[model samples]
Target: MNRKGAHLEGVFLDFPDLIGAYLNGTHLERTYFRWANLSNVDLANADLADANLEGTDLIGAKNLTIDQLSKVKTLYNAKLDPEREIALREKYPALFEKPDE
Candidate 1:
């Protein structure tokens, strides 16, 4: 629940269903989350630097800010809330690709 500095860097977590998991302050740098279901997950203060979120679903994810997502290495095809998507698109236009390629 309260995992501070949990190391999960560069791991393949493809298609994982981690909905509502508490991941506060977890070390997720460079982690690969291709198509992972992170809905409503708590990622407050989690180190997501260089994390790959390609095709990952981030809808309803809590405690995640645009700045945090911006610091990540990639976010191609990543799904986000409408408002958040708009904000991220403004900064990282390449992240939001058409047709989820």
Candidate 2:
């Protein structure tokens, strides 16, 4: 689905199949995306602050950057491109921490 620039704050979307969706510039603050399939999705300029991204699949997601992931609530077990994952982990280790940790 194309939801570029849409305001989707605090939305719950666990386990959603959102492969290749266009979500660039979307406002996704505090959204719940646990275990969601967002592979190849376009997330340029998307606001993901305080969002739940545990176990979400972000492999090959377009326009995703370390700055974006840094603001997220968590990425525990989330799937991302190897290089990006390494970069994120190195720069923002807290984002990968479990809630109970």
Candidate 3:
């Protein structure tokens, strides 16, 4: 679905399969996206500050730069593209910590 400029701040959206969705210019600040499938989704210009992305799959996502993800509050177990993951790893090492045996 294409929802450009949508205001979804502080909303709870779990386990949604939103592949290829157009979410540009959306206000997703502090939103909860746990276990959501957002692969290939577009997040250009989206405000995601303080958003919870725990276990969200964002592999192959579009228009999501390091600058944008840098503003996110939580990325625990979230799956991002390799490049973005590398950038985030430096800033949030806990995101990449190995699980205890």
Q: CA lDDT of each candidate?
A: 0.84, 0.94, 0.87
For model 1, how does the per-residue alpha-carbon lDDT over 20-45 read when each residue is reduced to its tens digit?
A: 88898899998988889998999999
Candidate number of the best lDDT: 2
**Cα displacement (Å) at residue 25, model 2:** 0.7
Of the two candidates 1 and 2, the one with more favorable lDDT, higher being better, is 2
Cα deviation of 65 in candidate 2 (Å)? Answer: 0.8
Cα error, candidate 1, residue 83 (Å): 0.9
Per-candidate TM-scores read 0.88, 0.96, 0.89
Error of 2 at 62 (Å): 0.2
Deviation in Å, model 2, residue 70 alpha carbon: 0.4
lDDT of 3 by residue, 1-101 (tens): 98899999999998988999999999999898988999999999999997888889999999998878877777788898888898889877764543332
The sequence of per-residue lDDT tens digits that candidate 2 reaches over residues 17-79 is: 999999999999999999999999999999999999999999999999888999999999999
Candidate 3 root-mean-square deviation in Å: 3.2
Task: Point out where model 2 deviates above 4 Å.
Answer: none
Instruction: Name the runs in model 3 displaced over 4 angstroms.
Output: 94-101
